[model samples]
Target: MARNRTRAPSSTTTTATKTQTVRINGARVKITTKAGKVTTKPALPLEWELQAAQVASLRRLPQYQRQFLLAGDMNASKRGPRAQAQAIATGMTSGEPDLRIYGEYGRLLMIENKVGQGRLSPAQKDRHAALQRLGYTVLVIRATTTTEAAEQAVTAVLEWLAQEKGKAA
Candidate 1:
C-alpha cells in the first residue's frame, strides 16, 4: 500500500472587484481593484483643502508671494460655540472672503473658494456686494476638485494682474 500523498495548491488569479478607502493629505479617497487593476481618485475636496491649494499655487508666483493674505477664520463654526462666540466678540466679521490680494495702486481683489455645489451665504453675498460697491473685485470660484480650484484661482489672479497692468499704462 502506498502512503497518502498531498499536493500544494496551484497559484490562481481572482477577478472579483474590491474597494478601499484611505485618507490622503487629510482627504478620504476611494480606491477600486478589479482583475488585478486598481483605480483611485480623491474625494471632493473640502473648503480648507481648496483654500490651501489656491494659496500654495498663488505663492508660487514671485509677484504674488508677499502680496496676498489668507483669512483662515472663515471656518470658525467648527471651533465650537464658545470659540465662535469669542471670535465674534473680538470683531471677527462674518462672510469674510478667503483671500485678499493687494495689487498695484492699492487695488484689491478678494477670492472666495468653494467646491462641489457650494454657494455663498447671505452674509457673504451682502459683504461681496458691499465690497464690489467700494470698487473692490470679488470673485467666487466653484470647482469640482482642488486642482481645478487652484487653476481657477491662479487664472483669476493673473487676469486681475494683467488688467491692473493695463490700467497703469
Candidate 2:
C-alpha cells in the first residue's frame, strides 16, 4: 500500500479594494471613497445659476416690445388667401396685432407696438403693409403709458387709417 500524502492550503483570501481620489485645479483634493464609489459636491445652487444666465441673455436686447393683434377665425386659416396676401403683399405673416379697434361703422383697426426709442426700420414698414393688405388698418405705437404719451400713438394711427378709408370710400 502506498503512503497517503496531503498538501496544506494557502492562507490568502481574494478580496476587492476600492481607491478614491479628488482633484482641484491640478492639485489632488481630499475625497472620501467607500465601496468603490465617488461623488463631488456642487459649487453653486442650480436656481441661482439659472437666474444669472437668464439675466445675461436679457441684457443683450437693447429694446423690447410686445405686439398684440386682432384675433379672428380668418386669422386662424394659415392657408387662406387673406393670410397669403398679407404675407406676400405686406410681410405680416404672423397674425398678432398690438391692438384691435372696432369702429361705429364696423371697421377694424390693427396696431403694432414698439418701444419709444425703437426706430421704424424697413422690415417694420413691410410688416405694416402686410397688415394693411389683410384689410385690417395697421399702425405703429410707441412704448409708453405716461399721461403725455399714453395712447397718443394709437390715436394718430387711427386718424390716419380713417382718412385713408375715407379716401378709398
Candidate 3:
C-alpha cells in the first residue's frame, strides 16, 4: 500500500494585511495612513507632460513663433456629438499632430509627441503621411518608459532645429 503526503500551507497569503508609507514633498501637513490594499494613478499624463516640455523648449528659441497645436479628440469630458459637429464646422480635424511651429524664413515644423506607452493613432498616421506627401516636415517623438527619455526627446529636437538653422545659413 502507498500513502500520499501533503505539506501544510505557509503563513503568507494574498489576504494578508500590508501597508506602505509614502511622504509627499513640500506638503505642509504630511499625514500617514495604512490600508490593506493601495492603488495609485499617475500624477500627470505622460503624453501631455512630454508635449509641454517640447513646447516650452520651442518657446525659448526665437526662430520658433506663432505655433499652432491641434487638440481634436482630446478632453473626452468636453467631447460629444454636438461638440464634434462644432469642430467639423470650424474646420478642426482629428489625428492632427500636437505641435506645429512657424519658423523664420518660411521654415515649418510639425511634431507628434508621445511618451511611455503612447503611440500614434490610425488617423494620426494617415495625417502624417499626407503631410509628408505635401512636402511638410513631420516628426514623431517617442520616449522609453522614463522621464529621462522624455527630456532627451525634447533636447534632440531642439538640437536638430539648431542644425537645420546652420544648414540654411
Candidate 4:
C-alpha cells in the first residue's frame, strides 16, 4: 500500500475582521464580521424614521390634523406578491407622494419624503408632473437626519399655508 501523506492544519490561522457600510431602509448601516460571524448596525437615520417624525410633528398642529393624509400602498407592497397585485388592480398608483396636504380654496401640496442621497424615481417624476399639470404643488423634501427632516417639512408646510393664507386675504 502506498503511504498516505497529509499536511497538518496551520497553527497560526488569521481571522480577519472585515467592516463595510451598506444601505438599508435608505440608511447607511455598518456591517462587521469577526470569526465568520456578522453584525450590522445603523449608522444613519432611516427614511421611515424621518417620515414618522414628520408625521408626528404635522399631527401636533391642529390645522394639519384634518387636512393631512398619508398616501401610497406601501403596506401592500410589503405584504407579498398577491397583495401588491391586488393593490394595483384596486387603483393603487405607483410613485404616489408619501403625504398630501389640502389647503384652502382646493389648493394641495404633495410631499415626497427622502433621506440621505435619495432622488425621485422616474415614476415619481411622472406622477408629480401629472399632479402639477392638474394645478397641484409638489415638494420634494430630503434630509440626512430625522430632526432636520421634520423641521424642514413643518417649516415648508407652514410657509406654504401662510402663502395660501396671504392669497386669500
Each prediction's total of clashing residue pairs, residues at least 3 apart in sequence or on different chains, is: 0, 4, 0, 0
Model 3: lDDT of residue 122: 86
lDDT of 4 by residue, 18-114 (tens): 9988988877898999888999987767667777888888878877656444442253136577987887899878788877777777787888877
Q: In model 3, which regions exceed 4 Å deviation?
A: 1-44, 62-78, 144-150
The residue-by-residue lDDT of candidate 2 on 18-120, one tens digit each, is 4444557855444544555565542222222222332333233332121112232222234777768866586444435444544434566654544445565
- Candidate 1 has an lDDT of 0.81
Q: For candidate 1, which ten residues in a row score worst on lDDT?
A: 67-76
Question: In terms of lDDT, which candidate is strongest?
Answer: 1
- Candidate 2 lands at a TM-score of 0.32
lDDT-sorted candidate list, best first: 1, 4, 3, 2
TM-scores for all predictions: 0.70, 0.32, 0.58, 0.72
Provide the RMSD of all predictions against the true structure, rounded to 1 decimal.
9.7, 20.4, 9.3, 6.0
Report the poorest 10 consecutive residues by lDDT, candidate 2. Answer: 64-73
- The lowest-lDDT stretch of 10 consecutive residues in candidate 4 is 68-77
Sort by TM-score, top down from the best: 4, 1, 3, 2
Q: How does residue 36 of candidate 2 score in lDDT?
A: 54
Candidate 3 colliding pairs: none
* lDDT, model 2, position 95: 39
Of candidates 4 and 1, the better by TM-score: 4
lDDT tens per residue, model 1, 1-169: 9999998886986789999879978779989999989999876777888888888888888776464444444643577889988888998778878888777778888988777778898989998899898888899999888889999999998888889889989
Better of 1 and 3 by lDDT: 1
